[model samples]
Target chain A: MENQVTRVVFYVSDGTAITAEAIGHAVLSQYPVSLTQHILPFVETVERAREIRTRIDEIYARSGRRPLVFYSIVAAEVREQIVASQGFCQDILAALVSPLQEELGVPPQSTLRRTHGLTKHNFERYDARIAAIDYTLAHDDGMSLRQLDQAEAILLGVSRCGKTPTSLYLAMQFGIRAVNYPFIADDMDVLALPPGLRPHHDKLFGLTIDPERLAVIREERRSGSLYASLRQCRLEITEVEALYRRHGIPHLNTTNHSVEEISTKVIEMLGLERRMF
Target chain B: MENQVTRVVFYVSDGTAITAEAIGHAVLSQYPVSLTQHILPFVETVERAREIRTRIDEIYARSGRRPLVFYSIVAAEVREQIVASQGFCQDILAALVSPLQEELGVPPQSTLRRTHGLTKHNFERYDARIAAIDYTLAHDDGMSLRQLDQAEAILLGVSRCGKTPTSLYLAMQFGIRAVNYPFIADDMDVLALPPGLRPHHDKLFGLTIDPERLAVIREERRSGSLYASLRQCRLEITEVEALYRRHGIPHLNTTNHSVEEISTKVIEMLGLERRMF
Candidate 1:
């Protein structure tokens, strides 16, 4: 209940809420502290500053705690004006730097001190959602596993057969964006390749490791479950491979190959056009 | 015993062992899995190939496991020559691309899979270590905490104090090399800052958040220990701030600053040059 207050506020250039949000997300990642962030942009007015302060007050009152309020867009002139205006106190709402230095015990030159400021002031221009989507596409996490439209190719595999990690490796090591789907027992029923996969089947590839290895990995996750049984895993793999064969899906057995090895083999096996460097 | 024996053998170009060790010390990261890479320069002789292969063999034999062996300097012809002369097969050995694909379910692009291959192929001319270090500097764990000499600055703080992530935002946005160092209690006791740090106090910046907020984070991590003790943390912070004030350490209390706010303050406070557009 005490943790429900906002502690940080991110300021950005005019009309850059999304940029501030992205940076806020990035900032939240470093420390494990609990606090919410309020986005205040285009802080050219005392009215906006007072509004932000009021909002902070409401958050504290509702949560029965005064949350840490951060100000990202607090400019020099704005600070001067706010001091004269009602409800804004300059003493409590200092910049974030002094505290961080005191916390880390870093001397003046420790690059750690300048890390965030440099990134925010000097970062790539945040293109709108379209570009963000593109970046995410180029760096897909392989969760949906559904057919990838933008993907030049797709990979189908059994769990722990190394699908998500491999897809990421492909995207990063090379610029070729790849999408992967795990072959769960649920997917075993998905005998027919989804419609989105048909156009890219020639570019599509499948990977399977030994059933014993698959069982070993599954066991690590669930110790004793129908999901981890060797017999079911073997059958699932066998069925998936047959489905791939029936549908003319190019397949590889990744028994001993590392993720890098398989990626190379897929390129060699499928003769797919180079999507990455 | 078994896990210790068969450590992965990764062969790359030079001087990256420090980076490799830093990265490989972890089991698997969000990016590339860091293994004990045996970086080898390109060798032209059959005897050298044999020597390298024998060393690789001993690494595997001692580990009692077939660690993912990644050979980075391999050229197309070099791969062919190594295979032809040393009779290395896929069952035991793997080049960067092929093995990685197998490991990750990624399709390997045969071009520039090796370390030197990456160096040669990268339009950016530098050694493999430098290339990897640069790439990692920007995108390690998809987080940007600039570590190399390239970083222009850093942000330091306690857990949830927003250091690593903020640095990344700056780097990605500004193209500035930013790193973050978490300040531990030991850092305070040392009386002096770490080497390479004393001279850069002019560039040093800090971020501090509210103690109650920090307490919430500590509670999440330790729940019931001295970590969650508000009194103890308050004392630590008071002492740290005293030290900062004693040394004229200019820092910002992130207690009320959003990441953007904190970053902007850093820029203003340190008069740092911006790297991003």
Candidate 2:
């Protein structure tokens, strides 16, 4: 039982459960616990809630410990049923909605799935996101230096050092037009900004990571290659950081950071305004 | 003044300010107030905090109304300065940290920017996300059908029907391997799933949208093409919905939904398990 120490956790929501999962992940990460997650998304009906409660109770009975549930269900009856469950429940939306309603002086519409729905005014934001995604995909890996002028930021990084995912994350999350340019071996040795990136130098932000981390990431892609060697990673990273300093282009090490962290930090460092909601 | 009604809003943080912006966005969306935002990120020093306080006070003096500030500063002294300002403050991180500490029975690590950092356990999730992103990019728009066996979900939709962005969002946010296949004009007319998608029928989820909305979206991309015409959009949507029913495939209309909503709906409809945190 000690070796099989797994706490059953559920992220239950009437809608997508994304909000529940986001807040739950943030909160749960602060604690050092081994969790097994059961995401019961779209738990809109009383029957669904009842079924989820039963599953949670079963887990609790087996483990001899209360299950942890983070929920964002909006329907009153459905919420009540979950409340009656044996598991310890954290009501994510309910906890915020009252304070928000009081602050805003307007009752919520309480419409199902309203949080992630697009309003008339926000359609432009959607369009901007789509545009950013397209821009990011097209301009990925120095694909089109001609459109460097259109990019809000050009990410320069050694291969496998967290550029592509961060670019796509920035594009999708904040509608920031991000383009990533990989620093290849030839480019790294010279320690010069790529000829294509020179005119748009202000938009350049470098991403580097610990060489050991880079080696691990690259080895997963292509094992036994010199490209995945720690020495190669160290040389590339050192040169790229030097290149960034020489060009006065600010940079961050992506060693311990997630894509979300990298994207937000990049935005902060560059003083880039989010193009849309 | 009625037409010029605007509230000054600030998202203040010692790190990226993403959490402040996220909670603030959710809270402020419930109100009808039009906001002019001033994001102050990486406000670490007391001097910077005082400067921000002065700025907030100046905004209050000009508008004759207190500005709204959503802050996630972890440091006590810096948070105090923001609290001392004229702005009406909502302490987002403070609201959660205390509750979380009490619930988890441990004081917070209080480390700046730890919320989005990577842990050793989560590195596998990061690898999964990179794999997903690569898989998505390769299989985008029916580009490759050889690996349909590998996809967690296959999106079927008409052209310009919110497939690409939704796929990218799922991959980045949830590490879900999503591949989107666009239904071409010929395929829509035939009212059939593309041959490439036939083998993966169980994995298919359809995206449809209002014809007028589709027309508006398409018009932005290709102004005078037949594909952008309202008649063409209506024809494609009607046929696609019919095709979804004929195959008993679940579908969602993305007309009023954001990418987040669509991705979640798709995941729910298919009962897809998120591959990572």
Candidate 3:
């Protein structure tokens, strides 16, 4: 606080504040300013807004800088109360509501917690995601070979190539039925696909990593192990890439990719539709 | 497509297009119109944007309804090309950029794919998330009681009270080290906390569900068992509530709550900060 000029930022919302935080983080990432953020959720009442306003004022008094407030409060009076505080208050819901009202030819509902609702009508969507999650957890690491047929995409990669996390993310986030099979020592020796995966060639997506990076990742888990050796990593990666090329399996280098990036690339390459939003 | 006027909607971006899709879905949920969605990710080049433009025109020509394009494309020319497409184009990045630039008194770096980059410096963040995921998975269902000390939060609930998914979601989405411990028959008989969880009572959050709903959920897993009986469910839920009250553990009824809602509420109640955005 002494050397760096830190500004207080609040993601204020009447609901979970996910939308506010999403828009706030995206907006704030552009700025080259150090920020300390507070999530003030369930600020539904004017009194609560005023309390937050007073807190912001206190911060402003100490720092001699106006705090930045990003809010998605649906209530007009409550939003106004927060705006009255000493800060640049950006109302995400207000910006969205007007544009949406005009576009939809109707005024927006000023209700709280419109997002993340699971009603009876939307139960199937919830159930589908749960089913996908169950399927992913059950079939992880080629555990259930028979269930491979039901997978939207079967991810094949060496250990620590990020198959498990990516598979779970694909299932949980998008409700995509993803099953991952790790290319172990036995499987990597032969240049042929495993018997279980041979039938699902069209649904297979390969994840490859730099041998150096793979070695480093594995070394973190089990140092001095044969599997974590750079030489072993190089051999396995080379063999896996050759197999991918030989089989015409679409693959992506995941050495520098996040799970989001890997999942997106797999979805794009395979053109897998997201089962749920 | 016939009864409901179907409009083609594209969530377009140079990177994952996740932000575009999230905001698009939130905005479009207000409208009652049925939508046909296409995720045209990695639309980095003007050529790719133009190709998407052609596809939008084709859809518009066939459906006689202008397509909706929600984009987070950072490149000006690429975004312009998408805007020229036959649709009502909404630029999420543009809406965010100008306001943020004005507030911060600095123009944002119009760099493509800024969100999901995995550089050396950012590896710690990724590693933290992976570690949390591993911790959550290992400590799930009290599989390893010795590892309970490592967990940031311990979720205690009756069987099928939405513990596993919530824990996984928290770990994956927020990088929170969450472990769920279910109250089995032996543990529930005595009005005392498990010996393993006694020291970590402060970290425990209880989840209760409607007896009828709990019975239904248990029935789906294993039908006609004593565990799935309504009377048993009522007894268990009653005892769980009494335990929560006696132990002063914060609890939430997850009868009608989605995982998102339940997780959000738990975080709010416990004042748990998300390790990642």
Candidate 4:
């Protein structure tokens, strides 16, 4: 058997640690290694930083291998503690920031920064994002049709075809007010666009899935039922896809795409404004 | 008046441009510049790449300044097109990946990478994330108490105290099954832990907000109503906070925190497993 190398990886941040984790994951995905991951977020205090440092040192002492640390810290004191650790520490944001700074010919604003933190300037945009989430939940799975006009994008698909997650993602990630309506087993016979959605035809997007994949997903939800049977899955997909073609709606197959991919594609296809919060 | 530098920024990627946007946003936040942003995802084909190159060149010609492009493309031909554009381009992932590669002593797997794409290997984890989203929605706003035992975390807070969005974020981002219950005005008079939740006290987390901020948020939902009044907001906050203290529930103030911050804090405080999907 081939020897597989293992490493302990830590994603540490003074704030949410989301960016640290994101960049670290992307970077590490390129290498072939097994990772035991630890995420340490909100390490703002010097005391917490020392504790993390000690933890890293102990892991190094026990394993005889320096753990990898990917971190972003705004505070000098807190950052210093992590830098002192017995680990292969990488400042996730500093590399990119320095190049951009040189390019822009300006010194970085020397202050505590919060990449994922909410501030007075961004509070309004943040509120809009929350409101979008509210609007999305209310309109999920055809729950409410009263305010279809307010929706930026309306998703049409059969049940378990990946509409709810995609709608919520659009709202959560981009602050887009998204509405998703599912075509159920009952609606399979006559899968037509609802009258309310007709007025918002331009906002309509569709999602379809392969029958084999659909059956597997449905089987997990309802085992040994007709809903999970391949034949029914095939029929639903066929009818729903035909409906999409008849309506001239831009659609995507959800069988292979992740929620992020689906949401980004939907936004791009519909030309929806991608508001960054 | 001092001349303020304004730049056009583009985030391009062969996959979902989420990572590019995230790193770019974090890096740009350090600089004092006004940015006009464009995000182009799935720039796989040479045709799309060429089209984007032209668009970048056109913007440069019109503005008499080079645009800043932050991109991550896997294909050599496609990446070459973007690199050849008349923009100051930066490979967002390459900077960090190279240093890490030297440290790990391994070359990167030279394959088309998708940071946000779903694959057969990660399909199960991806499914669990979707399931977490499903679980969170079903349990949102105290919708279902049947599965309290299955919940990873239970959030208790007053209305609009940043519960639903946080719960969804916990699920969507970390695949943690989160349930949020609101303490409404009706419950204030007889405020006590619901008998159903008492069994799962270890899983309980409280969210409180400043009365003044609470009033503002409530006002947006229903202006000039008693529910949105300062007095009501104060009373509800006081009662819920006391309940948190009395029950020994670990809690946080959501007044100044974003959903990302709140969710990260909650996970850290509870020592919940942070699963990266």
**Best TM-score goes to which candidate?**
4
TM-score, cand. 3: 0.94
Candidate RMSDs in order = 25.7, 3.5, 2.4, 1.3
Predicted model with the maximum lDDT: 4
lDDT of 2 by residue, A1-277 (tens): 2553456788998766766676676666555556888887778899989998899888878877788888877688999889889987878645455565554455766555345668786788678888999999998887887777889999999888888899998898888899999989877646677677888888889998999999998898899999999999999988988888888999998887778778888887888987435
Report backbone clashes per prediction: 87, 0, 0, 0
**Candidate 2 chain B least-lDDT 10 residues:** B93-102
Ranking by lDDT: 4, 3, 2, 1
Task: Give lDDT tens digits, candidate 3, residues A118-236.
Answer: 66667667878878888898888888877676889899989989998899889988899998888897776665787768888889999999999889888989999999999999999
Interface RMSD per candidate: 19.0, 3.2, 2.3, 1.1
For model 1, state the Cα shift of residue A145 in Å.
Answer: 7.1
Clashing pairs in 2: none
Compute the lDDT of residue B226 as modeled in candidate 3. Answer: 94
Per-residue lDDT of model 1, residues B37-156, tens digit only: 443433445566666666666755775544443232224545443343321223111211132233223353333322212222332222222223234344432254334455556555
- Candidate 1 CAPRI classification by DockQ: incorrect
TM-score of each: 0.33, 0.87, 0.94, 0.98
List candidate 1 stretches off by more than 4 Å: A1-147, A272-277, B1-277
lDDT of 4 by residue, B1-277 (tens): 1566999999999988998999999889888888999999999999999999999999999988899999999888999999999999999888778877777888998787678879778879999999999999999999999888789999999999999999999999999999999888999998999999999988999999999988988899999999999999999999999999988999999878988899998998998998876
lDDT of 4 at A145: 91
lDDT of 2: 0.80
Candidate 4: true contacts recovered, fraction: 0.77
Instruction: Flag the better candidate by DockQ, 3 or 4.
Output: 4
Question: Candidate 4, which segments miss by more than 4 Å at Cα?
Answer: none
